[model samples]
Target chain A: MRLENVWLRYHRRGPWVLQGIDVRIGPGEVAIVLGRNGVGKSTLLQVAAGVLRPGRGRVTDRPARVGWVPERFPADQPFTVTRYLTGMARVAGLGRAAADEAVTSWTDRLGLAAFRSVRLPELSKGTAQKVGLAQALLRPPGLLVLDEPWEGLDAATRELVPELIAEVLAVDGSVLVSDHRGETVRLPAARRWLVADGSLSEETSSTDETIAVVEVAVPAARVAGTVARLRAEGHQVLRVRSDASTAVSQALPVEPPRSAGAARPAEPPLGMAGELTAEQPEAADDAVESAAGETR
Target chain B: MSALVRMRLAGFLRTGRALAPLLAGLITLGTLYGGGRAQPAEAYGVSAVVLFPVLAWQTKILLDVEPDVQRRLAQVTVGVARERSAGLLAAAVAALVTVAVALLFPWLVGGVSGPVDPGDRSIPVGLALGLWAHLLVVPAAVALGALASRASVGGAGYGVAVLALGGVGAVVFGLTGSVAPWLAPPIMAAARTTAGDAAALTLLGLSGWALAWSAAVVGGYLWRRRAQG
Candidate 1:
């Protein structure tokens, strides 16, 4: 998909939210969009998703089936979770049986099996976000655009988000996701696109700073603190294991602290093995199994 | 496009909001039926007074059931033209029901009284013309409602406009003894039905006027939407 020199404003006299922005993402590539608040990140995503038309220039080669999950899903509708997902699945071009099966599968995968019959308006924020995610994935979109997909999600579900992205990528689909919390480190590899001042630019990371996936094992009681400490020390803790065992392992980068002041000591902390493992970007399955084994 | 139309139609039908049109239609039918032994003019006046505004208001309520966000989302799936067509089709359904009830009420309640011209095979012809004429009100009122919505007019505002327009049309037709002045479908139908001479020409003229008015209103509405977009 490609947007070539797109310019957009809400109204004829309104100021432009996006100006001369050109970007493209090929099939199976994930593009992580970064920007501060009110910097047209959502607008860019909407234009790319075909929800909004640009005033000048054009978007070409967008897939017929594009899935878009807005920052806040409009969950005040009268339908139940299952009904809504089924309707959306049909709208996205699924057959009756396919739509039903997709709805059931996505609801279960997103941990919304219990809320399938529950009305949308009655759901909590996290549950509603899960429903939003499920709807976006129900039809296996050719291009997936998500705005703040991680916001309001529970820890375990947040961990599952990367797997969802990987699933889409495995099907040769393109994904464009916007995140403010930098949680996209969980993605295997992503091209960073930064939006500022109504313009977009691709940011290139230096080759010297490589991201490594580390497996951490800690007691269940210290899981939250361990993840927080890893994050505080400038290590991007991707996911924490969610099994019924005393030991918990997290996959995180082995990069040093971003800031000199936040740097940790040369030695790894107690009960936390910060071994410098090689870059195993496609080792998500092995990581899950290792985390589960440590818990046993 | 069919899916969107079905969705809108289903949404309109499955809600309590659908009752507004039904109630308005019932009231119009009742008023027309109560005008027993009266001339067709009385029936037409009653229809104008009660049916037009209420039907317009009911259509507004039905259309409002799909929130703006949902509408926008649907528009993304089906283009804007399809979305607007679906909404208009739904409105037309409500209008058709109301008009059918109004036109058929007289036959249902018992044939019209006090008017038996042996040469006047024009009653059925008049009835057909009237049906065609009155059906035009649906598209007109829906177009007016769409324009009102675009202008951000509240429901009460559009309702009042519809009622006032109908009332003024009736009053003007009464004073002029000509349906052409107001372009009011009900009044034109009534005038044609009561007119003993050249009823066919009058019916044709009335149909032409009603259709022209409907086309103009709906055309203007489409123009405004395109302009805004």
Candidate 2:
């Protein structure tokens, strides 16, 4: 999908929320829209989602199926969770049987199974956001646009979001998302489009600092906690392999310091393993298994 | 579109927004036909005239039931045109329900009295003309509702004002339509035609005027939405 020199204003004499914005995202691509508050990030996402038509230019080659999830799902309605999703599925062109199946599947997948019969207006913010996600994914859309999707989500669901984005991309769908919480770090490879002054500019991803990979060994029970800490600290965990040599053996490769001035003395548990040249997958299956095992 | 219509109707019913206009319509019908018997066509003509505002109000209520965000979601799910048409269709369905109740209310009150053209007894002329008048008014009323919809004009207060004014215009100008019939919906003409011995050409003309008014209002509404977008 492509927006060609699009311009938009809410009212006839209103200031332009978006001006001369030209952006394109292809199949299998994800674009993360970044901007400060009230900078039209939501407006840009809305335009890309086809919710708002640009006053000046046109959005061309928009996919037939576009899944749009707003920042806040308006759940103050009369329908229950299941009923609402089913209705949305049918609106998205699913047949009755298919709509039901999709609703059931999505509700369960989003951890909303227990709330299937619960009314929307009674749901908490987090649960409502999950519902919003489920409705959008009822049918795998060719273009998925989410505005502040991470807001009001629990930790587990927050992690599931990147997985959902990956699923859409796996189907060769394009995704446009706006983020404020920096949770988008999970999508390290997503293209970043910064919105400022009612215009969008793409940011290049290039860093030239020297790199180092530090390997750390922690107890099996602490493995999950340690990995979480490392990731939170801006260090990338490369791999997690169980060791039969001891109770458990884990290898964590940490990224170089964010800045040269922040270099510090090495810690005991963390030792500098040789710098790894290649980037590892963000969510390795073994890492997930280790985390789940720790939880269990 | 069907999904949207169904959702809107469900919302309309569940929200209880359908009650005020419905109760108002029933009460008005009861008061109009209470303990009084008249020619079916004439009574129904007056009934149709009063029901015009009621139907328009109901349509507006139905159209405005869905919140803006949900409506946007529907628009994204099924394009703008389909979503919009769904809202209008839902409103039309609500208007039809009111029409059905009005049609039956008089009979429930034992208000019909009269024969057809002195030779025909197969179909009651009052009933036929009542149905015809209602059919004639539905499009125009729905259009007025659409014009006064929250989508067309922002804010609840403003929408109500627009609808009330439009309803009054349709009634007043319809009654005095001889001065400038094209300025308002042909509702009064419909009632007059139903109550009197009207020619087939005249009936066709009323239908044309109603349809033309509906087209203009709906067209302007769709254009406004597109422009606002």
Candidate 3:
């Protein structure tokens, strides 16, 4: 599916959330919509989900199935986890008997069986997020839209997220997401789209990062595993620093975003306005040199 | 409709929240008309009985939201808007019915074999009808709270709203004319006035109003759901 010349906005004086954004996800391709907070990662995802109509452009090549897991799981009822997922499955058009079977399968795969009998409000944040994610995957979809799904999960559960995505893709579904810690993902072919200043552009290792720079290195063989482990632990493991063999100092393994109600980071970036990346932003030689030099 | 019925039933069992208070109000009203029965030596159960709706709505609205990605993604989910609206209305109506039944129970039971002559039960009828009218208004108020939740409106806001709604109902009943007198029927549904003139008129009017408002609120919810992306 491709979004072409699309723009969206809220009430008057409300900033333009997305402008002149264009990108495409080919058959069987996954694209991670990337940006700091407030960049309309959700709005864009909604538009794709057909929940919101775009103000300016068209999102084309849609399949009949669009799956979504918003940041918050919409399980406000006192229904047990199993009941709720089955209810959602029914809503998605699955028959009762089939929906029940699907719910059981998803809860097992998502490791929510322990919580199967618990009501939504009583579940922990991570458990709740699992429910939210399970809502979309109960049945295969043509496209899956996940908004910051890794936010409140634990390390073990976080590792399962990418695998879940792979499973979705395996069944011929494509995924679109907006996450920052990208290294741990096994979807080696993911395209990156950076959103800034309400504009969307495909980043190809060239997007600029004006923030402070820091570099640390580990063995190459351990790089992917190390990064995945760190991210699963919930650190904002930025661009991989693959240049040296700086021995491990006192290390804080990446932590999965804290439990569901975990305190949100103080200030997210500006809304998606500047540009989007359909691939990794190119770290120019000079810029990498400067980022490497900035630390010294 | 089954979903709506299920939600409404859940609303009934959520006794510790809004149902408790609504039940308390009914109990008091029933006592007034019951020739005085149905009260506990302690007031704790009464408090629990009467304040259920307010508690349920306040808790769900204030804390149920995903505080983390609230602004960006809390409401986005699967299914169409009508599904949510129907579910909400079903839930709210079911809850309201349970509360009405509890409040009106004393008079209902008393009518079967008590000192109050069956025909003179208008007072209990009025109070019950009055409270049901109030319950009918609650879902809209709670939904308003739910909608405004994204804006971070506090419990104080809901408190003010519920108190104001209740107060207004009381004041209207105090006035020469009933404030809305809109819910006279469901309140008066089991009244001894089952065969009266004024009693039937008020009941019809109140029923029409509650039904209309419920339909309208559910319509609004559906619209919002459809509008979301």
Candidate 4:
């Protein structure tokens, strides 16, 4: 899929959010979009997903089955989780039996078994996000565009996201994801597309060995297990601190983490951590828990 | 196309928005059946006029309840033409049900038996004309509702507008006797009972007018959607 010189604004008189932007993603390639809030990341993704039309230029080679998960799923709908998923599956051209099976499998896989019968409005943010993910993955979309896929997910499901992306990639489906958190580290060899000032710049990963700094925080009790898991995932645990302050300082090889040894890490200990330099201070606690609480 | 229509019908039924029109139709049917014993043509004319408000309100509800995201999805899948047709079909079905139930009321109450005007035709013929008139008006009302909604008119506004238009048409028909048949659908339908030689011509003219009006409304709606996009 390709966006050629696309320009967009919310209204005719509104300032342009995207100006003369051109980007492309080939089949089976995953592109991780990086940008701060309100930098047209969602708009770009929406344009790519065919949800929004650009004012100028055009998108070409868009696949027939394009699955897009917006930043905030509209959960004000009247259908229950299973019913909604089944309806979406049917819309995606699945037969009744197949739609039912897909709904059941996705609900179970996303740990949404208990809430299958619950109405969407009654679901928590995290559970609703899971439902959003399930609906997007219900059909094997040729192009999958996701905005903030991991924002409200639980730790286990957050870890499961990479596997979902991998599954789409394995089937040669292109994936585009926007993230505020540094969760793109979990993706298997993704091209980085940085969105700044309405224009996108592609950044290819360096082949030479380099060092990556990551912060991890866990309860002092599970420090040993967390360290072991980090090392098993091929990150060198440069330092480990044991305090009510949950801070993890590490220096790792820049190569993509080995998927074979990337087991679910141990659950984190209670108490909040100081903000990591790369992450927002307000979101530090949630980020620490997300990064640490990945035990299967 | 059938699946799309079925989906629309199912959604309308599940949401229970069809009940408002059904209730109004029942009331109108009861009133018309009670009054038609004396003058069948007038009863059918009044009933046809009553359809304006009932169908306009119902169509507005249908348009409001249609999910925007689902419509876009359908555009990518089954195409927009089929989606639009399905929506129109669903609204037409609701209008048909309402008018059909009203038409059955006269039969249920032991038929239209009374002293008929010298110029008036048979009860069966009047009822048939009423049915045909409804067949035309229902879709026209649905299309008008679509256009009104695109103009940001609420259901109440649409209802009032239809009532006012019908009232003005009735006044013009009353003032200009010979032109009544061409000016208003209810007048044209009511005239069907009394005019023996020109009945076929009147039916052909009303059908043509209805078709033209419906086409214009649907065309306007499509143009608006394209322009907005």
Candidate 5:
């Protein structure tokens, strides 16, 4: 699916929220939509889902079998979670038995079997989100548009989300999602797009392309070896420090930790000590547990 | 055409959920002392008949059940603009329920009350069709009341309240309280009129208005679907 020169505004508004935005998600490709809040990230997702239309431009190649889950869902009915998913599947034109079977499979996969009888309003946020994603995936829609699919999930389930996306792509389905958290995963690896300043910019990168600039300070004699190792590992390595670190020197600057199931290292980046990552098994676990306690 | 229309009919039949309460309410209404000797135009039973039908139309979409239905309805293929099936089904349910309530309820009530004559059968039919036709306004009201869905503490309570309000309005307008019935629909006005009466203009006006309402709502659905952020 693709949108070209798309412009949109709401209810006698002055300027458009989206201006001349252009994008395309090829079949079987996973495109990660990135943007700040109110930067039209949700709107962009809605347009692709056919919830909203481009005001002055054209949207083409949108497959009819598209599945979408909006950010704020309606939870006002007496429908049980299973009943809800089956209903949607039937509405999407599946036979009743097929719809029921599909719902059963997805609910089991998403770990929602325990909550199947619960009404939508009673489920916790994460559980409700699982139902949302499950409904969209119930019938294996050709195109899946998700708004923050992994938001509010616990660690283990968050790890499973990218796997779910990967599985979808493996079947030749397209996946488009918006996630503020930086996530890295293995399949169909994704191209990123930034929705900003009333427009969308394709921030392109791929698995084969170099992305990181790793500056290293080793013994002058070992610098060449360090650079070679980094290059062989597919890193965009840069040499910032020519001399080795002394006893008092710090190895690298620290940044905020990525969410669990994301790509942040298990231990601190090579030298920050136990407080950072849980790298060396036992001691690392203790430090992580302590950090989690401090957070609480 | 058959698939869409047939689905619409079967979906409309599922609207029977609304009848559960309506039948229960009828039992209570039967026990209550009705305005027994009042003119046919002043019947309170008129409103009671249509209440459940409207309620049924509002809640049957199953969108309220799974996967964030309201957003899906308004923003996805399940909603009216994305597909005609839901909208047509909604309308058919409303119309059928209206006819059933207007004709059947009055006939049932009159039989129980021991009326000698059929007591203005034409008028009740007109009133029912008119009211049923008016129900086309419902989906727009529901879409507008998107916020109410949250405020109702769930959805069941709000659905009941909305049905009551619509039913009450229909009954109140039926009172031959004056030419006021003329403003409601041709059916109600024609009920009290003699054959070839001058009030025939009211029927034409109401039918035109009803048709216009249908066009307006469908048109709005299309526009809202096409509109962007």
Candidate 6:
């Protein structure tokens, strides 16, 4: 999808929030929009998602299906978790049985099954954010646009955010997201688009060698073994924090860490890291411990 | 589109925003029929006149039922055009329900007696004419409601003003009988025709005028929405 020469302003006479913004993202690609608050990052995401029409120019080659999750989910409505997700699934063109199946699957996958009958207005911010993600994922979207998706998420769900993006990318769907928090650390390979002065500039470097603070989540029982394994493999072990959530995140650099005097160690084996992503709630049975360490 | 309409109607009812206009409509219907039985044509004509503004109010409430963020999500799910069309269709459906209640309320209250002064038309014919008159005014009221929606006017106070002016304007301008009666819906003409022994040709002309006015108002709403986007 491409936004060609797009310019937008909320009001006709208002100052432009986006100007001459031409950008493109192909299938199986991810673009992370970076900007401070009130700098048009959300506007660019909305334009990409086909939610807002550009006053001048147009978004061409947009996919027919777009999943748009706003910064804050509008949970003030009179709908329960199940009802809202089912309604959204149907709105996205799913059949009755398919809609029900999708709702059930997403609610379970997002750890929202317990709140199925709970009204939206009664959900906490993080839980409501989970609902937002569930609705967007009900049907595999051609383009998924998320604005500040990690704002109110719990640590475990925050780790799930990268996995969700990877799932969409795995389907050859283009993903566009705005992240002001350093949550993009997990998305080391995503291309960066900086929004400033109502214009967008692409950061073309995909090979930046910098020290990345990786957050790895593992089952509490395996926390000691995982940290020992990571340290023995020449990766630096950082602080460990335990939480009631079950799942560990691995925060490591996309490229090798740069140190002037020290000999560079071989890249850590990703086989075990991938396995850590699975939610072994029975293993944790109590808490998921996250040892967010950086390899120096 | 069907899903969007269903979602909208469900949201509107669940929010309980339907209560105010519903109460207003029920009160209007009770007042119109409380005195006792009357000719179906005249009673329906008066009901249509009173129901116009109430329907307009109901439509506005339904249109504004969903929050803005959810509306944007719907736009993404089923393109902007379909989402907007769904909103209008839902409003029309709500108006249809209100019309049904208005049509049946008189009968439920024992408000019908016989034919008009000419004493020639059947009960079914009067009821069909009543339904026709209500349906004719629905599209026009929906347009006015769309014009007064939060998307169109922004502020609640301004929205209310627009709705009141549009509803009153349709009646007042239509009553003038000469200068630009076509500018507004032929609501007064409909009431007059339904109340009296009017010819089929005159009723057809009223239908034409009402539809034309609705089309014009809906056109304006579309223009406003496009510009806003």
Query: For all candidates, what are the clash counts?
Result: 0, 0, 66, 2, 1, 8
Candidates, DockQ: 0.23, 0.60, 0.14, 0.20, 0.21, 0.62
Contacts from the true interface found in each model, as a fraction, amount to 0.12, 0.81, 0.15, 0.06, 0.31, 0.79
CA lDDT, candidate 1, residue B133: 46
Order of quality (lDDT): 6, 2, 4, 1, 3, 5
* Candidate 5 segments exceeding 4 Å error: A184-188, A206-296, B1-33, B37-69, B73-88, B91-95, B98-102, B106-188, B193-209, B217-229
Clashing pairs in 4: A216-A248, A219-A269
Interface RMSD of each: 2.5, 0.9, 5.8, 3.0, 5.3, 0.9
Give me the displacement of residue A264 in model 2, in angstroms.
17
lDDT of 1 by residue, B67-86 (tens): 56566566555556776787
In model 1, the clashing pairs are none
lDDT of 6 by residue, B1-229 (tens): 8998999999999999999999999998998899888877778887988898999999989988888789888988998789889999999999999999999999998988776557556788788878888988899999999988887777799889989898888778878455877767888788888877679899898898888888888888878777766
- Could you give candidate 5's per-residue lDDT for residues A127-232 as a string of tens digits? 8888877878777777888888776555556667777887778888888888754433222368778898889998765434422212222344544554556445
| Candidates' chain B TM-scores in the order shown | 0.75, 0.94, 0.45, 0.77, 0.47, 0.95
Span of ten consecutive residues with least summed lDDT in model 5 chain B: B144-153
> What is candidate 1's lDDT per residue for A1-296, written digit by digit as tens?
99999998877798988999988899999999988899999999988887777889899999877778878877767678887787776665678899899988888888999998998889999999888788778778788888999998877788888889988999999999999765676663889999999999998875533444445455566677766665555455544444422222232222222432222233333343322122332343332223211100
Q: Given candidate 1, what's the lDDT at residue A242? A: 49
State the displacement of the C-alpha of residue A149, model 4, in Å, after optimal TM-score superposition.
2.0
Candidate 4 residue runs with Cα over 4 Å from true position: A206-296, B28-42, B73-79, B105-119, B150-198
Residue-wise C-alpha lDDT for candidate 3, range A1-296, written one tens digit per residue: 88889888864356779888787787677888877788888788887876667877898887767777886665555678887777667656688898899998888988898999998878888889999888778778788898778867766667787888887778777898867644324344677777888887776743443222223334456566655664454344555543332211111133322233323213232211111111222332212211121200
User: Candidates' TM-scores?
Assistant: 0.72, 0.83, 0.61, 0.74, 0.63, 0.85
lDDT of 2 by residue, B1-229 (tens): 8888999999999999899999999999999999687777777788888888888888888887888889999999998889889999998888888899898887888887666467432336568888888888888889888878888888788888988898888877877526777878888987787766668899898889889999998998898778756
C-alpha displacement of A148 in model 4, angstroms?
2.2
lDDT per model, in order?
Answer: 0.67, 0.80, 0.54, 0.68, 0.54, 0.81
Off-target runs (Cα >4 Å) in candidate 2 are A208-296, B116-123
Q: CA shift at B94, candidate 4, in angstroms?
A: 2.8
Backbone clash pairs for candidate 6 read A214-A251, A215-A249, A215-A251, A216-A249, A216-A250, A217-A248, A217-A249, A218-A248
Residue B34, candidate 6: C-alpha displacement in angstroms: 1.9
TM-scores of chain A across the candidates, in order, are: 0.73, 0.72, 0.69, 0.75, 0.69, 0.74
Off by over 4 Å in 1: A208-296, B28-50, B103-127, B150-229
Among all windows of 10 consecutive residues in model 4 chain A, the one with the lowest summed lDDT is A272-281
Return whichever of 2 and 4 wins on lDDT.
Answer: 2
**Which of 5 and 6 is ahead in TM-score?**
6
Give one digit per residue, the lDDT tens place, for model 4 in B13-91: 6678778777877777777676546345446555666676667667766765656655555454454566567677777
Q: Indicate which candidate wins on lDDT.
A: 6
